[model samples]
Target: MTATIHSLPRKAEPSLEPLMTLVADGLNSVNTVILDRMQSRIPLIPALAGHLIAGGGKRLRPMLTLASAALLEYGGNRHHKLAATVEFIHTATLLHDDVVDGSDMRRGKKAANIIFGNPATVLVGDFLFTRAFELMVEDGSLKVLRILSNASSVISEGEVDQLTAQRQIETSEERYLSIINAKTAALFAAACRIAAVVAERPEADEMALDAYGRNLGIAFQLADDAIDYDSDAAEMGKDRGDDFREGKMTLPVILAYARGDAEERKFWEAAIIGHRTSDADLDHAIALIGRHDAVEATRERARHYAARAVDAIAHFPKSDAKAAMIEAAQFAVARRY
Candidate 1:
């Protein structure tokens, strides 16, 4: 008798829809605050800021704030304004980042700096930061104010550190993690910690949420770095190989360079130092990354952090909010764009 063979079903890819659905109403309120606060007497201020604010970002940072509040079952409207503040801080950073990177595209559209000019973009970024502070002050929570303000400062310091590391192939994994922890993860931690403050949750709870956000942020950044070199990856809004061309010294480059042979090392040295910048050069770089499995290695690193993010909230009683948070961390590692 011949036996019939059965194939196992593939696991479905993780998605952000559950988290988005959980925070939908709260996010709507946050959007209202964002639109109202972003308005200004100076037409250019609103116009330039609106260009990026209306851009197709997932608004992940603020959504984390809202979701954290929901997880705590917090019944207050204060988080809406605070969530908007989180978004302002994030948007300000993006505006400045595009200008610093000399990017041509943001959220699949022309970057604010390209359309409004670098000076205007920078000023608008400053305007958003001021608005963020105003919102924090209006909330009348010194603790909240401190957390967010410190995050803003850390983000700036991280940006400066990354600028110093740019084109420096000597940038170590430890140093790169330090930079991302401050620049990218700091705001995520702040966003989640403030939810505990609003909910009157204990310090331990606050720390737990902070850990979750921080790890998730690192995972998100790592996945993004891997995508920049992954040939089969979908377009991620920004120009492909922007990190390579800019010599950002991301994890993939670090791994590939470390694992490369002598001839490959020579090619990487030339690429990182601005000697190789053509499309052909980028193709070769991608090929080298593939040969070393650097992209997969970076993604594996992301999965590690994503698992930590999930465990950070594991003690919480099972609820829709908790499940959504767990899935969000999985999505961070699994996302291609």
Candidate 2:
């Protein structure tokens, strides 16, 4: 009797390389627009903005715009400036978020506010927002203008809602989702939706892309939340345990709190209310999270949204663009840093 050798199939690692390659040319144009539009006669405007912009961000939002255009086979250059606009809006939010969170580090370096002072950092963020609007008006589409502007407003509202919920241990999962949907996912949705507008695709197609971006954004944020507490995870650039110190009720914290026993609940209540915030407290917090397997639970939630994101674009015909997008969603869940 002859026995055949058996081999198991290796799991394919998800990656953004395909998406990046697919959008390379369009991304170059968007980068040019970003570099040009971020400049100003006032030295501080460009100086402060450049600090964060040149920082090692993945530029995922603008890339999403380019990828959406690729998926639609849009042959126009209109998306270049619009993609830059989405990036400006996103950068502005990051600057302002760092200030609001009192963050000292961002993207593996000192935050802009730390180097430039909060006032200058804030003004530069405003300048970026102004540049974003200028790009929007130059795009000459009322629908595009409305979508991005509304997203900007929604992001502000979400930030405010999150602030109100900060250190409030009673924050429910429903409310947390609502906050991220606006603060993070709104720009993601707008970024992709505008591509459909530029392509002149029908409303249904636009909605499909919007759903894809929104769910992907949520998945990405959830993964970030899990990384913050994952003991074996790589450095995330931002200060580790910043969320715990800030008393931000991320999903992992929410889940851990919800599942904690009476003793564990007391520790969480104190931690969220700003009582327990030492390095040891963070370690204990991580311990409690591990005891309940909350980080993995958070990752599971991310996988759910990532699957929804993939399904959102299922009706689109098979192409490199579609396959790249599906992999991007998979990457969102698989990424640790």
Candidate 3:
């Protein structure tokens, strides 16, 4: 599909810049802890982990952990190690995800599979995953482990479900939500919940932080799906139309197919479901998405989630960390560049 697109996410209630300042500094400290914790008997493990670790991502999960801990007034820097643990877990997932999806790029660079081979990349991902569990054990809390383990399970399940569900055309929003919650929001929920655990906060605060992460993650993934059609390869750091090529079921294509006129619907059936797609069919799909405003509609929904994520943090008393956490939620929605 070929069409122009535009989105101007509504302004955040509070500017995220000041909060990002604190988060930016904390990440360095977190990385240090992650590195120190990783010094172990298996030297190959670290070398393999290093290959993917060096690839830059947004670091959203670790940011949530540190910010949430700071909000609850954690005195020491324990959150730093935990934050790195969170990042390591997240990176491990990405490595496995790329392998599973046969992906070519991440953060606008060659995927580990391209550089290190799929087997090595897969093993490194395994190393990071185990290391994440090992690092979190230092917290000496089963609650934290439970959250992370559950997230890991859910993420795995989600990946499997998505593999089966993609390009099926019969996929529903209800099913999509289930898949994304498991695949995307599970980790996000864990990240925020772990911070609350670190603070020894009340259950209500923990639940709210969990909700914040869940909502933020959903919004982030939805926005990502919305952008896939026209995203610049350079900007997205990956191939455009990847979800389409892979026959993935994402919000834009689903809503567009549901709402499209007869001819447009046929395009989805022939190109997407039947895999009979030609350039003409592709362009038609793109046009129908724009005509029905599917992408914009998804963006609107994503913004609503971001708003809810910000509101969830209101339970904590205002602090630099809290503000940063809130801004991170806002950043999840509007951070296109």
lDDT of each: 0.90, 0.91, 0.78
Per residue, candidate 1 scores C-alpha lDDT tens digits across 1-337 of 2111111112378888989999999999999999999999999998998899899889899999999998999999999999999999999999999999999988888999999999999999999999999999999999999999999999999999999999998899999999999899999989999999999999999999999999999989999999888744236887899999999999999999999999999999999989999999999999999999999989888887887777788788889898888888878877888
TM-score of 3: 0.90
Q: Candidate 1 at 323: error in angstroms?
A: 0.8
Count backbone clashes in candidate 1.
0
Error of 3 at 72 (Å): 1.0
Q: Residues 1-337, candidate 2, lDDT per residue (tens digit)?
A: 2111111111378789989999998899998999999999999998999999989889899999999999999999999999999999999999999999999999889999999999998889999999999999998999999999999999999999999999999999999999999999999999999999999999999999999999999989999889999834236887889999999999999999999999999999999999999999999999999999999999888888887787788889999999888889888878878
Alpha carbon lDDT of residue 191, candidate 1?
A: 93
Extract clashing residue pairs from model 3.
1-282, 1-283, 1-286, 108-237
Which residue runs does candidate 2 get wrong by more than 4 Å?
1-11, 231-234
**Candidate 3: how many backbone clashes?**
4
Q: Candidate 3, overall lDDT?
A: 0.78
